[model samples]
Target: MLRSAARSYSTKIRSAVRVPNESYIKDKKVTFDRSFPVQKRTKAWEKDGMDKGEWFKKNYAHVHARQKSERAINGDNDPFDKRSKHYERIKQEGSYKREQFRNHRSEYTRAHPLQGLKPNPLIDYVYGTNSVLSALLAKRREYFVKVSHYGPLNTQIQSLCNKNNIQVEETEKHRLNLLTNYGVHNNIVLECKPLQPPELSHLGVVNSEGSTYDKVEMDYDQSVNTRDKFMTKENKKFPLGIYLDEVVDPHNVGAIIRSAYFLGADFMILSHKNCSPLSPVVSKVSSGTMELLPIFTCAKPLQFFEKSKEEGGWTFVASHLSGSKSKTHLTLNELSGMLNELPVVLVVGNEGNGVRTNLLNRSDFTVEIPSGRNPEEARNTIDSLNVSVATALLINGFAN
Candidate 1:
């Protein structure tokens, strides 16, 4: 009886549904994310803020102001015109002096270095804004500035020259590219006096003690110039000097001068042979420290070292390689034991091959920077430190 009832229920369910095999209906539409309409919405905070049109002006106010200043200098708007308010504001505010900081040099003429050492002009080009500005303020050279016809920089060049008497020439923008020799001149070019290499012999007293020294021959004018320029607060004090033996790279030479001067060395002696000249690059690299450093050339460095020891009581020290096997070898720390010995000369050598073997032999004591690394690592390391770096380390450790 239960089986018959179940069969009747199944028959009823089968009769209620239609079979697919008999027929098919139309296809339904398919929808993808790309087909959906985008919903536009705005955040409550952003709703009251800046519009798209005002965004550029607000965000780039400084850039626009700079451009405006340039236009005034370029004759774009009357505001940027030569005598415009933009230029006048700088004059009133004395903003040009921004580049002229700590400029001790006034209008007084620099005593020309001795006749033979009169620096022959090397290159006419002076790049970088600070360099040209320093050269002008230093009054170290006569500069003829080339600038774009009309702009803020040109206006600055014009204003600086007008007061200081540097000659400024206006040229088309394209000319600066040619003038600076494709270097990054930033649209300004200046031709100033070349770097002057002073003669070594004329630098200071060839002989400290008149009885033991042979005077360097010089006329009245040369004597006056030498006295005026090289004579300084420290020159007359007890002697402390540094001798660079053929450390030729200009960057190194400039950097060493800065380090030597700041570390209280009274003066510097640069070798004429295989040494970098006193160029604008060196001058600028020294952060204008070259201007302050009392530099002298050494035609005979070995003789000068010998004289410093024999005649003057200057201690002759050097930074030679560690374990040099020389009898005078001492670590940098050991130098402190000898500071009671005042007058000293620190000698640093060339980049490739250090102080000549003869120079190393002449040193009163050879100081070495200790190798901090383990023995095995030290073996695979570089043989020598950079000439500039070694000079700085030696200077910092130098006895006052």
Candidate 2:
């Protein structure tokens, strides 16, 4: 039995391990042979003895011509041809639509010239909860429209609107954003007439002793007493005022006004030509302080300065850099000593350019804030503070 089992195992091993066929091995070897013939490749320049660049130029034109002929024959059967045609059609359609829109816009603009071309000056939009509430309470501007708001309106705001017979409407935040020209609206906007402050001449005369002006006439619905309250005799005694010399940034204008009003400034004078307008933005940034402060417009600031110095007994103190080239210079500590000597007007200048050279020359005192760094260190670093910040420091120094 052992011999028979051995024979059967040998037979099974031989059958499982069959040898490869000689012809099949030879055929497989031939299929992978590295000695196979390869066609010689040569450039046109090599074949025709032409310049490499010229040969390539000719070859490029010939290749493109062949491709063009092939595309004409194959038409949309070629994937590239089909894709290019599809893109061309889409581009043409887009251009045609754009042209149509441009023509339509032109016609609409021609038909309605004044509607959207310019902003309406009579109506203004005031936003922010504090600003809107303040405008409603101030009653300096006429309110004939509704208050648009998003989310829950403030209780005080809703109550004021109701008391004033102004309507309140719930609106989307986007509408509020549009109304405020994307300003920081705080989700509430009020529509009202623009607040127009009276000029310095219209309000009263500036005398050497003090504000010897008559009672301000109330042209609008504003009470005469309210106007008179700001210009009282006590407030004008040794009064401190701010003169904005071509300060055109609305934000800086608003901020300076806010600081001045908070620090008990008597009045503000704005240059008529270059100063920022008392727009809604100024009111919003000022936190409605613009409504409370007494503002006067001076068309010619140099003349106003001359007149104030000669006749009004006002001292002009200009905020200057620490090492400015002004003839008269005073440190903040020095400026404090003379705050009560006479009526003072603190002149702050434009953001880019400092106080105009002429204004600096005209100023009686040019005040500068002392830097924490020494002169050498301060010269190497940021040498000056922002006009608004410097103005606040000067105002604080004078006020205290």
Candidate 3:
């Protein structure tokens, strides 16, 4: 009796539910394969070993003809025209603005080819608090164009500018940043003519006349007189000048200059070629010492050395690395002792390569700073000091 009741209940449930036929279900069902077929794609030009331009022309000649015909029909040949089909296609590719900008830039560049290519030779933007203040105090530049500060101007700077009749403008920091090319401006910037150092031949003139060195351009006769005066001075100062040989880094140059000036060196000499320029960055790095220091340029270094040795009896002492095959004739102590006997020009060399072969050979004395580190321990590591540091040490040695 129970089996019969369960069978009747199952029959009623099957009748209540609507079940689809297997054939109908099969007709509605869909299947997708999980695996994707991978194929290698090769460019037609690469496969045919033909030039890309030739292949493009051969395959897309019909497309080009069609485009030309459409362009003619639309009466527009300009690629930059907003209504042109070419411009519309570029817009679809999301390069419409880029193409427009590029077109405008090319036109502008062609119209003014050298607009920003060269910097203003006559002017320089001196920045940083120390650099600006020092420049104002030194009055090295020919004329002060103006002074601009992001915040309240320093009282000293303001007074100096007012006395010199220089214009002062309160400006935003971003403007100062732009003027200094994002250098460490310290909220102040100065506009003025660049400092123009006289040639190396004017060393005697610079030594004799203090601040008016630039004003007196001596001829050969007057230069000789000045040289005699410098050499035969009663006080016997025996000025020691620092010569930079291919020191390309401006920071190193500035540091060396500052060190030389602070250590009582008479003047600074720079090789005309392969030496860093006296840029505003150098001036700032030197903390305005560059403005105060008297600098001279030597166009032909070897010739100048020879002439100075013969005529002025100046000694050339070169700095070299230790543990080298080249013999260092004198140590720093010995050099210091000899400083009083002769007028000396200390030669510091390039960062990577030491003093040039010819200059090294020409030097009367080659001095190397003795290292404190053990030779065996420090052999693998950096053994030489930076050019600027070495220069400072050497200058201090000379001064003492």
Query: Quick one: best lDDT, which candidate?
Result: 3
Off by over 4 Å in 1: 1-123, 140-160, 170-189, 202-239, 322-327, 336-340
How does candidate 2 fare on TM-score? 0.63
Clashes of each: 5, 0, 0
User: Candidates ranked by lDDT, best first?
Assistant: 3, 2, 1
Tens digits of per-residue lDDT for model 2 on 234-329?
A: 323466778898999999998998999888787888877788999889999999898878787765567767766765567889887757654578
- Which candidate, 1 or 3, has the higher TM-score? 3
For model 3, the local distance difference test gives: 0.77
Best by TM-score: 3
1 or 2, greater by TM-score: 2
Residue 265 displacement in candidate 1 (angstroms): 3.1
Instruction: Give the TM-score of each candidate.
Output: 0.54, 0.63, 0.64
RMSD from true fold, candidate 2: 15.0
Which residue pairs in model 2 clash with each other? none
lDDT of 2 at 209: 56
Off by over 4 Å in 2: 1-119, 201-237, 322-327, 374-381
Go through the candidates in order and give each one's C-alpha lDDT. Answer: 0.63, 0.75, 0.77
